[model samples]
Target: MSQPEHDAYAASPRTLEVEDLHVSVGDHLVAVSGVSFQLRRGEAVGLVGESGSGKTLTCRAVLGLLPETGEVDRGSIVLGESDDRVDLIAAGRTVWDRVRGSRIGAVFQDPGSYLNPGITVGRQLVEQLRVRGGLGRTEARERAVGLFTEVGLHDPAGVFQLYPHQLSGGMLQRVLIAIAISCEPELLIADEATTALDVVIQAEILELVARLRRDHELSLLLVTHDLAVVAETCDRILVMYGGEIVESGPTEQVLTDPRHPYTRALLAVATIGDWTRRTLDVIPGQPPSAGEEMPGCRFAPRCRYATQACVSAPVVTTEIGPGRSARCVRLDELDTEPGAVLVQDRIEATA
Candidate 1:
């Protein structure tokens, strides 16, 4: 894919800063707690964990599309830098109307669901172009076709007239991507965007995202449960569990020398480059329920190295290395070298 012309919006720094964000559902259930991360301009960050880990909630919180029963209880989600920054949590409808789609674009898992079934996909993109891009009808139509082409769609003009259901999964996703980047948003949040597709399609989507990020200089917050996906596409990784980030660092560093037990466990089970068929290792215990209170580390119950110290008091997130942090009471005790025995291997060896 070729790089598009640099627009005024692309010149500004678009940094997504989420600080101590807490999301609450219903009256008292805190679905996300103390979750924080930053995505700088032209950077790709992956938020990875098993389901029920509040990844979607965090994404929703940033997008201001949380369910009616859910709201940000505390913390701030600021976009942009310096005088141009806007706190999404405090922003009202007017601010949100200007921010979403225009400033920050998102592509979710179900592309068909987000699109209007009755409207032709091309017309959908055209509407966004006209409304958000402030282009005339003719100009919007031309730009929409160009966007479809930019996203690598075949027969872009022909595909424009098809409804959501008329397209294949990969094609629909591409259409969604066309709409997402049509406004030239600086930040793109892809929440499980490739989860529903097959392996080949998934790889295509990841490559497309990477290309778009490079061409557009767009910051990416890719939310997924697959570490392999992060390993391939993201520059940094945030390993989330039970509503909080358990470990975060440069992708290569964390994958090779994981400081947190939960991260190691995830790496052990992940099918990254190991093509040899074998029994898949599984994390021994279930993730804690949303808003489930725990005395110490959230993953202590499942961690093989956990002891009384790990459960007696809340584990504080500590900096283990440059730009690397993990929430574990036993971080010092654990081996942080590459090829270290994983917790799962230890369990299997004993069993």
Candidate 2:
């Protein structure tokens, strides 16, 4: 059999490299189109977008949890040591089973869902360690307890014995963190893991994650709708829209000087600058339905400066140098809006 065309990207030291990933929800609905990015060990990669912009779905793909109908129609995700990069997209369940939850740990949107209400936290963590590390029961328990203490959970012994319903959201999330890193996994994926918690708790979790990454030398893939979170935590950011990455750069650069309309729109609406503000700039137009076919650019309907040229021209990655890139037809001419504006209509959907 011949090698897939995109395999040339396999040997980089990057812990994770997702290239032109296309995932379809079903026969017709494409959830992610041409998404690509890489994560080096000890670095953080953030994916930011509005609800339904495919941020969460992209992370799900990394964990091999695509909807039953969902198919990774194209792309490659290479993870592992040099010269031995494992292809995440083409790999079957057995391959994913070994790599996921072990080599690539994840913490999802709700820690509540992560814990089984009937099981004690210790059981969950110990079981996870045993499964992933192939440790004996005693060894797994010891490591699980050690992990609890490592995350700064006081009275780790007592907390380990409690069930999911017994601990506060923050505590449970911390336990999930313990499970995620117990194997000393090379990568950690956090998908809006703190969304359900309060701000103070969210900051704690974020800080804990950052600290753990630093202490363990782990790569991080952070997926969230919160740009503020990206600004505070991630080194590099990837902005997605209608499935594809529309812009990417150093987190600071993208936040302060976004070049794409979509990225600008995202920053414009951020309430981050004013906590007392009552309203946010709401972008108009619903995201195209999964796999909904379209003839032109996916973001065209909501873009302010779109023209006939944009209607037919495929959005391509335009380099902004220093690792920054934007997908736009008029990158230089875009009117930078520091704040979000409400766009109300599709007006003309075609050129």
Best by TM-score: 1
Q: Over the stretch 10-57, how does candidate 2's per-residue lDDT look in tens digits?
A: 233688888888888766588899888888768898999878889888
* Clash totals, every prediction: 0, 4
lDDT of 1 by residue, 121-159 (tens): 999999999889999999999999999998999999999
Global lDDT scores for all candidate models: 0.87, 0.82
Model 2 stretches astray by more than 4 angstroms: 1-12, 335-351
TM-score of 1: 0.91
User: Model 2, poorest ten-residue lDDT window?
Assistant: 342-351
Between which residue pairs do clashes occur in model 2? 29-290, 29-291, 30-291, 268-340
